[model samples]
Target: MTDASLAARAVALDLVREVLRKSVPLDDAFDAHPDLGALEPRDRGFVRLLVSTVLRRLGQIDALIEGSLAKPGLPKAVVHDVLRLGTAQLVFLGTPAHAAVDTSVELAAARGAAPYKGLINAVLRRLSREGAELAKAQDAGRLNAPDWLWLAWRQAYGTARARGIVEAHLTEAPLDVTVKENPAAWAAPLEATPLPTGTLRRPAGGAITELPGFAEGAWWVQDLAASLPAKLMGDVRGKRVYDLCAAPGGKTAQLCAMGADVVAVDRSARRLERVKENLARLHLTAELLAADVATWDAGAPADAILLDAPCTATGAIRRHPDVQRLKQPDDVAKLARAQGRLLAHAVDLLKPGGTLVYCTCSIQPEEGEAQIDRLITRDDRVERVPVTPDELDGLAELINERGEVRSLPGMLADRGGIDGFFVARLRRLP
Candidate 1:
């Protein structure tokens, strides 16, 4: 193996190990490592691909590695990291079979697993020969999901839909950007179309920041589904709008761009700084507050509020593959409780006849529909103002019976896929 390839493989191992062992996000891990900065741009790109591919297909990779191992109780951390690098090369990358296998063996030997080198070699060789059969027998594509997550999906979406969501996440996500202005001008260079809500959909490749509209802030990266809740607020022109939990403020930016008097509020000082940076780039303005929404009163009730409450973010699995590895079923229950509390608090801050848009990136019913159900049931002042068909022109498929919008990747495959999102708009009684 060449020194460059070896170094890249080592970085891949470190990334995978950190994600698995420490649950650090892949992007954060990459950004924190100075060694990764030394690699050439192409090698850096390769490292990201290798790590992301492994994360997206960890289930299949683990299955293959486990099949090769002799003992059931062998430590998972030792084998899983090595297999992640190997599987990324063999399955996703299409690296030459010999080079992929040999480099991995060298990686194992260098890590002082000299005794396991022959085992690694023999297993990978066998996998190279019959990996397809093993994948078929194990149904690697579907069962690759963690057991808890697989069961939860099965419970939530049923067998067929759960299978579809998992399969779609295996592929890399496309780069979708929300245009601040002049979608047509921006669309020309990106070779993308202005989808509903003025989002530009680009094919998933190339340097993100170097893309034409990115530097000038003509558009900012936001998923088509994620862009919906702010749109559902319906023309905030002169109204004061509070975006609770508005860190890294995509929704807050959208609100301000639409001419709303916006106060972007969140608890994290660090995250709020990101929101400030984004506002500066877009040449937009908002009142930034680093205070907890649950306890911090926003002076007086605003004309509108957008509470993008924190949840499991299951809908974003394709974009952030780390979610599959780090989040568990119990995490959903915990988040749902938090969402319930935040929703109640946000509703209290709503003025009579005002609009409050409640949203979550989670696909879990508890976090999305169920929480809304609980809200309207208890609050006589609140009523569901269903999002009509005309209002959701390009997103008809995602609208539920109750008028809530649920964006699933499967719903928008033709116009370009969108992230999983659930949005509910409610109007306080006059």
Candidate 2:
């Protein structure tokens, strides 16, 4: 391996360590790097791939490294990160066995851990040799998830279902885009398929803006599952729609594209600016408001409201691996509480007999089913409007027993997979 490649790997490893040990987010670390600006494009991509892949399989990687070591007495943080990067290369990335082993040792040496360099070298080489055997022996369930999280998932969704969800996240997610007007005309050159709700599914690649339809503002990238709740609100043409917690506004854009008068509200000015930019590119207009939805008032009730409430976002682990690393078990409950509060506020903003589409990109039942259950029990005016099989035409695999739309990554295996999302549509009685 070249000196520059090893150096970049080291920098990325350091960043991953800070994220794992100190809870710093990956993007923040990337922005703070003093020398990251000097890296070539390929090297930068390598850095991102290494860090993100390691984060995605952190539990398994740590378990493998722990099993390989005789004493397991190394500093928790150091060994945790070293093995994470090394295992990601050897096991997940298909990097040459020698390159994965040697580069990691070189990284250890550069970090002033020359004493343990031999240990790092020997263990990784052994891993490269017996990784498959080691993995087979490891408990697939415990190896892939933190104990509490695994247990929570098991309880929420049976063991088999939880295991399947974790396995699904291991694969790369397809890039999905939302097209304005005709999907066939816009998606043909891109060689993509138009899924339900006019989302274009394509293999992930290149800068989004550099994609064929991007320059023309023909479409904007949005996951197939993430685009559904807004669509479930039915035709919004000429209707007053309130999009709470809206920013980077894919849903808000969807509302405006359907000819709705939308008040897009979000807490962050920076995020709201992104919504404004997206609306401009799509040649759509919506009222953009920067304020916390939990506190902000829409001034008057709307005909329809889309509350894409925030949760732990466990569903998007494939797209944003950092979520798996940064979010803790307790965070789920905290986020559920926030979602409940936001749902209550959003419901209050809906006019009687109006539709309220409550949704979250969360696999945990607490954040989706349980939250909705709470609402149904307490809010007498709200009634469940179960999504029908036809409404999920191309997405039958995502519809659950209770009619909530749950898009698991494994669902659209043939057409191209999607993110895990739970969407429930409801209506307030007059």
Best by lDDT: 1
Cα lDDT tens digits, model 2, 1-430, are 9988787888888889878878887888887888788888778888888888888777778778878888865664565577678888887788898888888887877777767778888778888988867777766545656677678777877877778777777766888888877887877887888777678788875667778868778888889898888878998899999998897699998888888999999898988888888888889999988888997877899999999988888889888778777888789889999999998888889999999998888888889999989999998989999998888666677888888898765566677677889999999999
TM-score for candidate 2, residues paired by index: 0.93
Worst ten-residue run, lDDT, model 2? 72-81
* lDDT tens readout by residue for model 1, 218-332: 7788888888899889889999999999977999889988999999999999999998988888899999999988888777998999999998888898888898888977899
For candidate 1, what is the TM-score? 0.95
Q: What value does the lDDT take at residue 103 in candidate 1?
A: 88
**When superposed on Cα atoms, how far off is each prediction in RMSD?**
1.9, 2.2
| lDDT for each candidate structure | 0.84, 0.83
Q: Name the regions of candidate 1 deviating beyond 4 angstroms.
A: 70-76, 132-140
